[model samples]
Target: MARILIVDDAKFMRVTLSNILQKGDHEIVGEAENGTQAIQLFEELSPDLVTMDITMPEMNGLDALKAIKNKAPQAKIIMCSAMGQQKMVVEAIEAGAKDFIVKPFEESRVLEAINRVLG
Candidate 1:
């Protein structure tokens, strides 16, 4: 099972993700409400994977993804975005996100993306 850090501005999103990941048998190492906190947690926890929200207060996911990658090129990150954020998703992929999941997430898709990235 992978150790994961979940980052989202909404508490609901974080809880939803945590439930899905825990059900998948992955360990949730930490959760962050914004990019700044995400970055700090990433350094502290060094989780196997990260689920990062794109639009967040304090720093934003794209910037956080870039920062994490800069610090650790092998860091495995997956961008989480809402509908109509395809452009941001693309940018995230280019910036080194392993994959992405749309909001209002589906359990199967979430697990699929996590497994794919972890593999």
Candidate 2:
């Protein structure tokens, strides 16, 4: 299992994601409510991976992803987004995100994305 950091604006979404990742034996190193916080946490904790939301206040996930990748090029990240965000997902992939997962979460998809990125 890997250490993971989860970044999302929704409290329930964060909890749901944390629960799922925890069950897989991944230790949650930290959580962030927005992208700025995520970037800060990422620098401080340097977890094995991060699950980042696409939309957030005070700095979107894509911006944070760029910031993180710029500083730590080896960092592994999975973008979390909703349907109809294909363009942003493509941008994230171009910016070095390892993979992505759609919201209104499915357990299998989430797990699959995690494993694929981490593997």
Candidate 3:
């Protein structure tokens, strides 16, 4: 199972993602409320994968994604975006996100993205 870090400003979103991932048998290494915390936890935990929310306070996911990728070129990051953020999603992919899941996440899609990225 992949060790995963979930980053989002909403506690509900984080918990929801955690539940879905746990059900998929992936370990939740850590959770972060914003990009800054995400970056800090990323370095500290070195999780196998990260699910990063596109819009967040403190810093945004794209910036954090870039930072993480810069530090660890092989980092596996999956961008989490709400509907209507297609532009950001494209940017995320170009920035090295392995995959992306739109908000109001479905369990199947989340697991699919994780599996594809981990593979």
lDDT of 2 at 68: 97
Local distance difference test scores for all models? 0.97, 0.95, 0.97
Q: Write the per-residue lDDT of candidate 3 for residues 84-106, one digit (tens) a residue.
A: 99999999999999999988999
TM-score of each: 0.99, 0.98, 0.99
For the record, the alpha-carbon RMSD of candidate 1 to the native fold, in angstroms, is 0.4
Q: Please, what are the lDDT tens digits per residue for candidate 2 over residues 24-51?
A: 8899999999989999999999999999
Candidate 2 accuracy as TM-score: 0.98
Residue range 51-109, candidate 1, lDDT tens digits: 99999988999999999999999999999999999999999999999999998999999
Q: Which ten residues in a row have the lowest lDDT in candidate 3?
A: 110-119
